[model samples]
Target: MTDVVAFLPGNGHVDARLSFAREKAQRLDVGFELRSVDYGAADSFEALLDSVLEQTSGADLAYATGIGGLVYLALRARGALTDQRAILQGPVLWGLETRTFPKLMRLPLMPRALTLAIARGPIQRRFMRKHFTRPLTPEFQRVFFDGYRDARAFERWFAWLTPRLLRDLEQQLRGRPELLDGLTAWWGGEDHVVGIEELRRTEAALGQPISVREFPSWGHYPMIDEPADWTAEVARALAAPH
Candidate 1:
């Protein structure tokens, strides 16, 4: 059987990382494909889930990062997880329920455009500076800006930011801990976005044992910071038998 590696990128310009994913698949002597959710076209969370599921169909292994992790959880909830083998890199699977801003943004009184405006402004860079351990590389920064040229996409993503989604996902995983089976999670010890502590909390909340890979020196975006090492590890995983 021909093996394939499907990459589900997070919200942002993922051209470079997508290329790296292809290289990793090549190292495993497998075909490669990218299945990023069309945040712009999806009008509802259901639509977003469908987009991810459709894109990931027929893959031997699926790798998701950031928001992509949420998509996978949603799939598991619906009993439609396409790939039997999957990896989550710094997934935002928890903690949204406790975040006030995302909750406020979803309230009827809040203007949806406000979130998009903030995304396009300096606040995002400020957030990155505060949360990430190091400055974004020039290549990563260029794509970050390029992604904003499409305002509609950001608006769609903002619409799905709600505490209810996180709560529901957590509940689903808690109810069926087996949903997490066959999944391996990767984290950068230095990644402030989803730190080691949050990972622990997620593990506790789910009460499921998740396979983990910790890289002490890496940060949030290992593809930008340590492409060679990151790809090497992913290649090894792809080559290993299930």
Candidate 2:
């Protein structure tokens, strides 16, 4: 029996990662597993590698769902991960510069920041329906709030990362070049995290139209927004090629 593994950065939500894989697995009639990088387990690079080697095993294919995982996919394409094929999804191109160093100009950030703060603050204990404490998704609020006993324990669990994360992100922003030369990118137009234009630019800069898929109304995490459609496209792409 063939299996497909879905991977993500440890800080990422398990619900989101598994939701993407399990939905697609059901559609493709394949076995699925959720693997996560363990950030807490590594203080240095060598230790990080050992941890990744321990957790990430080859599969029929691995769906690399975010910037951290997509970077790993490109490295895997170059033979770092010799045992599996990788699918890149909604990859973040400029993280340190665009995402964290400073907020992007045209988007709303204060709301998100406040949302996160209130979600984890003292008010969280008393205000179930308070505006600041509530999340975008009513059903998912508990998944994030109640899923972790405390933030510290949740952050330490996944101790491995797909090896390409920092290196690729570092290189690309330095204007080194496109790492997508031999990789396929899967994206959606409605994805707020990585815009459609960014994906187009990446595909163009790579000098080829690698595979691209778009959806309507589904933001960054379309697997959760539009599961059935995402599943259909995923099955088709996995069956296509490296």
Candidate 3:
């Protein structure tokens, strides 16, 4: 099967993003069976990764965003996924350093209940706003709000952000350096969610150079903010020899 699996971000859904990916795949006439994985309702990080692995087991290509990219990398490392090519957009590879969280939220001593409360309350708006460089459209507002209000989803999200996940990711990358092969990274210059320096650190950890495409004007969600550019980039990556 010439399948392509699209992995959504933490607070994301298979709506406009997945539609855009499907549209691009159709436009390219690549005969890809496009599918999207939803992690919003997952109970934990491992559960989310398990769902992703199961969904994309037969995929030949994969597209992932934010933390979803990390999930892809982990699967690739574990030999759970054997996709020939992967397109990672603003992947959260640098662990906690890649994100901009409040000092209180990052504290190891912080209660999970307090963190969940903050995520569901005042911090939700800020968190959503950080993903876009422009104003929120009605559709995105609905998606963001729905995800933010789901307490269980926030718990899963927070669970993925812990230091243990970072350590595990690093070990995986180190153990399976081949995970970085046949991967193209797309990063937004104005992205507030991921740091450039941290990306460099991740590259060093991989011990290989990653092909990266930078969109200076776009934020975290380039597919939503710059669909044409994102599509063209994917097409180019797909067209390239593996």
Top candidate (lDDT): 1
Off by over 4 Å in 1: 16-37, 100-140
Give candidate 3 misplaced runs (Cα > 4 Å): 1-3, 12-33, 40-44, 97-136
The clash numbers for all candidates, in the given order, read 0, 5, 0
Tens digit per residue, CA lDDT, model 3, 12-114: 3434445555676577765555566756467766787788777766666688877667777777767665546787887777655545452345556453656
C-alpha positional error of residue 45 in candidate 3 after TM-score superposition, expressed in Å:
3.8
lDDT of 2 at 193: 58
Q: In lDDT terms, how accurate is model 3?
A: 0.65
Minimum summed lDDT over a 10-residue window in model 1 is located at 30-39
| True-vs-predicted CA distance for residue 194, candidate 1, Å | 1.6
User: What lDDT tens digits, residue by residue, belong to model 2 across residues 1-242?
Assistant: 54455454423354443454465657666444445544343565455445554556655555665544434643543445554555667765434233541232223454244346646746554444332211245556555454333333233222222224435534443332343433556666555556666555544443446566555555566555566666666566556665
* lDDT (C-alpha) at residue 167 in model 2: 53
Instruction: Evaluate residue 144 in candidate 1 and report its C-alpha lDDT on the 0 to 100 scale.
Output: 64
Q: Which residue pairs clash in candidate 2?
A: 37-158, 37-160, 38-158, 38-159, 38-160
TM per model? Answer: 0.78, 0.60, 0.75
Rank ordering of all candidates by TM-score, starting from the highest: 1, 3, 2
TM-score of 3: 0.75
Ranking by lDDT: 1, 3, 2
Model 1, 65-180: lDDT tens digits are 77667677778777776337888998876665564544565666354555465455476677667655556665655566556544344445546756567677777677676676
- TM-score computed on alpha carbons, candidate 1: 0.78
Off by over 4 Å in 2: 9-11, 15-40, 70-79, 100-139, 145-182, 200-211
Q: Weakest 10 consecutive residues, lDDT, candidate 3? A: 8-17
